[model samples]
Target: MDQHIAEAIGRPDLIHLDERLVCLRFETMKVVSALAAVRHLLDTGAVRRGDTLLDSSSGIYAYALALACHRYGMRCHIVGSTTVDRTLRTQLAVLGATLEQMEPCSDLKLDQKRRVERIHEILLHHPEYHWMRQYHDDIHYLGYRTVADRILRAVGTRSLTVVGGVGSGASTGALARHLRTAGPGADDVELVGVQPYGSVTFGAEHVTDPEIIIAGIGSSIPFGNVTHELYDTLHWVSFDAALVGSVDLLRRHAVFAGLSTGAAYLAARHERARSPERTVLFVAADTGHRYADTVHARHEEAADITGLAPQEVSDLSELALPWSRMHWNRAPAPAPAPRA
Candidate 1:
């Protein structure tokens, strides 16, 4: 029996959408990382039970860190992006986590920048507070080892393709890294990362999506933990395309997931079609409740996903609008671009 609610919430459900395609759905995915990270900090004497843990988040990570703090007897201070909704705000309050939300802004880059700046300011005020660098620390990867083992047990690593958003690199990167440890057939496990058009993490920063940049999948800034070499391929999915994929997923497979999941679902279908021998498992990071008004309610506006296809590109410079795919081939990270 699990001792804490965080453990239960972190546990993902493996649902087989088809013989070869699977959905690894989470209630709120980052709880795995947050709980493990906090536990590790306490174990290492880097922090005490009453120590305040600080971090910046868009939405999911904030709630995740709060839950972790609640379970571990720590205080959580979150510098939240403008995307943090009222429901999450109330939950954070009840969980005893303090949130410093930025002013409302649609531009993903600006919101992320503001949140980071706020985090730095807070650290200056409280020098003793521990900053849980979720974006840069490898400690976040520790929790996913068990998850990878579970996946390997259910669907052996033979010709396996793990698809998910390239968010902070903890989930997908850690899963692929741990899966590769299962001996012989481990080398066959391929990691395909899905990103938004404006995410700088994979060189898609040059391209701008007219609509919202799908949150949590991609980043406006560079993440140190994102081992670019772990990824075998890349898919830059726009908001409209992700919406269509999300709608199609619900209509067909009954998986009501977030924008990033929709993007991963779209990419997974494409990967599966190309490599029928591979068992494609994509991550559905969270539920669809938060996106109900933004995505599901606009189901009528969603285009027919069957008619869509990604524009394959050889270079980042060639990345286009609705969808684009590139063969990363376990390459090193691209040189950093000058920040605006």
Candidate 2:
């Protein structure tokens, strides 16, 4: 009976091939770990009853927060963007959570500042609501640390190259902190953060390009959860590279992942090339089924490889962008190093 039950549970099959490569699938474990963390937080009085959890997520995190909050008998208020999947919205509504759609503030790119302003407005209007800001909350690290711990234990090594994209920077930052504090087995792990070249806020300031299509990661404003000191290295990837990675994952690994995952994968590949003999790990943030129309659309095949093909569409004159093109890729120059 135990054997039958184990088979039914469907654990990820991990293959350890030599010291250089260790393939570990902790996706299912991650969800369970996140839920367990939520339960622990509720039980330990870190998250009290009747507190309204406010999350600024496009979809996945919103659903996780709603489901967890519902299970714990806590109210959830999701400040969702217009770009969020309708199916996710329906699920949240069914869970009895209130969803407020922030009016698009002259930006096709979901502006984080606008979302934050709406959240502030909601708080001001409803003083009874206790915003469980996931970005800055310490408990957000609880589940993320589990992932890093699992990687360290499974590989049986201290020197690891961890690569992942930053949404709110909660998971990425937490994993970095955990790896830094690990015992003898994980003393020299390096955490690298990847972001879209269009919206590079955490690593290095990049001008937000209006033409770029940002899917999962990258924030319009600097999130409270990310600290520049925590990251060992940062790489900015173009949307074209991310798209190629996404297509490659779908074709080769049969892994349907979102654009953010693609961005991270491409960055990981670059990092892997730098340290070819070392073990590199990347996070598959979410499934790509949600992006069937946008990223996976057959119509975008030609435009997707535009950076490589010169014949691809390049007329921005016909494209309508909400923000001025002047601000695109016009980031302020990096400050000079201090003299010793």
Using all chains and alpha carbons, the TM-scores for the candidates as numbered come to: 0.98, 0.76
Cα error, candidate 2, residue 139 (Å): 2.6
Model 2 weakest 10-residue run by lDDT:
319-328
Give lDDT tens digits, candidate 2, residues 161-200.
7777765666666777787787765657776776654453
Candidate 1: misplaced stretches above 4 Å?
A: 338-340
Worst 10 residues of 1 by lDDT: 331-340
Residue 235 alpha-carbon offset, candidate 2, angstroms: 1.4
> What residue pairs are clashing in model 2?
158-185, 158-186
C-alpha lDDT of candidate 2 relative to the true structure: 0.59
Predicted candidate 1 versus true structure: per-residue lDDT over 1-340, tens digit per residue: 9999899999999999997999999999999999889999999999998999999998999999999999989999999888889999999999999998899887778888888888888889999999999999999999998899899889989999999999999999999999998998698899999999888898888888998888899998889899999999999999999999999999999989888999999999999999998899999999999999999999998999989999999998899989999999999998776668
Best by lDDT: 1
